[model samples]
Target chain A: MPLPMTSNQVLDREFLEIRAKILDLAASFDRLDRADGSVVGDPRQSLVQEALSVLSSTQKDRAEQIQLLFSHHYEDDWQEKFNLPSAAKLRTRST
Target chain B: MYYFDPHIHMVSRTTDDYEMLAKMGCVGLSEPAFWAGFDRGSAESFRDYFRQLTEVEPKRAAQYGIQHYTWLCINAKEAENVSLSREVIAIIPDFLDCHNVLGIGEIGLNKNTKNEAIIFTEHLELAVRYNQQILIHTPHLEDKYQGTRMILDMLCDDSRIDRGRVLVDHVEEHTVRHVLDEGFWAGMTLYPTTKCTPQRACDIIEMYGSERLMANSAGDWGPSKPTAIPDLILEMRRRGHPESLIRKIVYENPLEFFRQSQGFTFKSPDADDASTINDRTASEPK
Candidate 1:
């Protein structure tokens, strides 16, 4: 039988995947930056802006996925066990 | 390495540009009617423009041993003036039979406005009625995504329109996949400022294998380069892409798409098998 993965292993894998995706996104941005620097105006600006918008949305979605994964893996008494602030407390503190 | 610039506005260009394009291996090009940097006053202005495209430009290109083809339509910017657009559309048939005239185009949304859509549909109707090919211009900058979506929706709704015969020009990275996925040809305009640069165009080619895709300079009166395709050639070479792949995108693809037009009887310089060369002068209209 296959051994069950520990929470750390699952989290590590997810982090690796997310990190790789971020690196890929950064590479795309770098390539766009390295493109012909002679072009200056709405056309070049719009192309870069649109690409960034797509990458930003993708990054946000990945972040949400990571948050969901963390929430799913958390113990029922995680807040108390970890001594983390409650949502209500965090909201108050943020305000 | 011969290349075909499937979409460019040569009316705004001087004869010197023609000589330069010929020197750079641009054997043929298509000039789609567009805004003359400003809205023309009347339909008569369009008539004169069409005459210049059909009569003057071809003769000038011929001097440099280049073939010239053209598309006719009141550009979307001027299509806002519906009454004038209709008048212009009415006179388009007079020039349809001209030897070098290809079809009706450079027609699509400008601002993604209602009037533009109305005029766009009318141009579609004319194209449908006459069985002409279409070349489209999606809007610029902030309006590009919405305008492209609107144009795609309009095109999709019309079942009579052959998606293959239509080419959506000025496509950027965001909009290009949607165009190609929907079974339509896409054109990447390589401009010095405002459209896809040579490197960016090469990147697009890498992302989307060039099937129905081609590139053009859109060499108009604005700040644009007429030799942009050659720059793309250089970029493709620098990236180590094979000559065949580059030729397919720059030369063969446009030829394949344009071959659908009855008026595009292009004879490549290499088709110089003796009998065919001799027959050319004999077939010239007396």
Candidate 2:
């Protein structure tokens, strides 16, 4: 059987993954901004928008996954103690 | 070369786009009510929007000799506001009898949230209650597969929905088979990006065959080409696909579907010509 990973190792891996995604998302935004400045109009803008949506969605999914992981591994009362609002509450407030 | 764009958003397009579409042999198009680039403040805003769709847009399209038909709904993005969506849904019936109105549509999941699902079903209920045809907007990207499955499942659960009269738009390769196999009409949106391009759409046609399938530009407020359907035509012709098959996807198929709507009274421009009578008789099987 494989050895269990230390929490720091897990955090490092996750942070690396998230950092890469953030860079990708930033690159996508940059491409969109460049496309906006160009004269190609519809096609370029659309291509960049599609790329941005995909990257942004990936970023959101990763963030959510990390949140779930953190919630599971941390103490049960950790959220209440930290005054961190529940996911449902956050969604309601935003909406 | 005459065609019909089964789905488009003329409300977001300028009059110049209408002229260009008409020039490119577009005889008619249907605009499904969707988000106006931002969340609307109230049901009254939707009321005015519907008025513009039913009243002003047709006149605009008429100037270019293009017939404009519309489908009404609170699009899934804004449907997250359940109380506002309910208010908007309540007002949809007011426009159903309008001459240019087609049915309740462009209604489906956005984020596939619980509230969105609730409003989707409520919209379905309204469509069923009124015997209206439906046009669905499946979510984009990663959400598309799951959202489409949920929409299809909900549709399957409701026997009242005639799968034939409903169209599930924005289908990609992964989801098209399911939509078609389930007996609902499918629409492939030809976009510059983010959706199927002309080449990909042609490939889909080759794989799926043309029965109960169509394509649209989905020209709206975003970065979209209103004339993307012509690009598909060119691509199909370049591939040596027969003109008849091309005509079926762009024209006859849309006619066949839109004919189900009581409000659709489209007459072909060639209806008065004697030479096309035989052509019409031959293609009527579609």
Error of 2 at A3 (Å): 44
Candidate 2, B102: how far from true, in Å?
A: 1.1
Docking class of 2: incorrect
- Encode model 2's per-residue lDDT on A10-92: one tens digit a residue: 87757645543443344334334433265346787567657757444423233223223322132344335535444445436
Clashing pairs in 2: none
Question: Which numbered prediction scores highest in TM-score against the true structure?
Answer: 1
**Which lDDT tens digits does candidate 1 get at residues A1-95?**
86598888887757645543543344355455555673447696567667767454324233223223322132334335435444335436766
TM-score between candidate 2 chain A and the true chain A: 0.29
Q: What lDDT tens digits, residue by residue, belong to model 2 across residues B1-286?
A: 9999989999888879988998899999999999999999999999999999998888777767787899999999999999999999999999999998889999998877777877888898899989999999988755777677778877876777899999999987667888999999999997764567787677678768999999999999987899999999999999789999999999999999999999998878878653322232232321
Off by over 4 Å in 2: A1-95, B273-286
In candidate 1, clashing pairs total: 0
Per-prediction share of native contacts kept: 0.00, 0.00
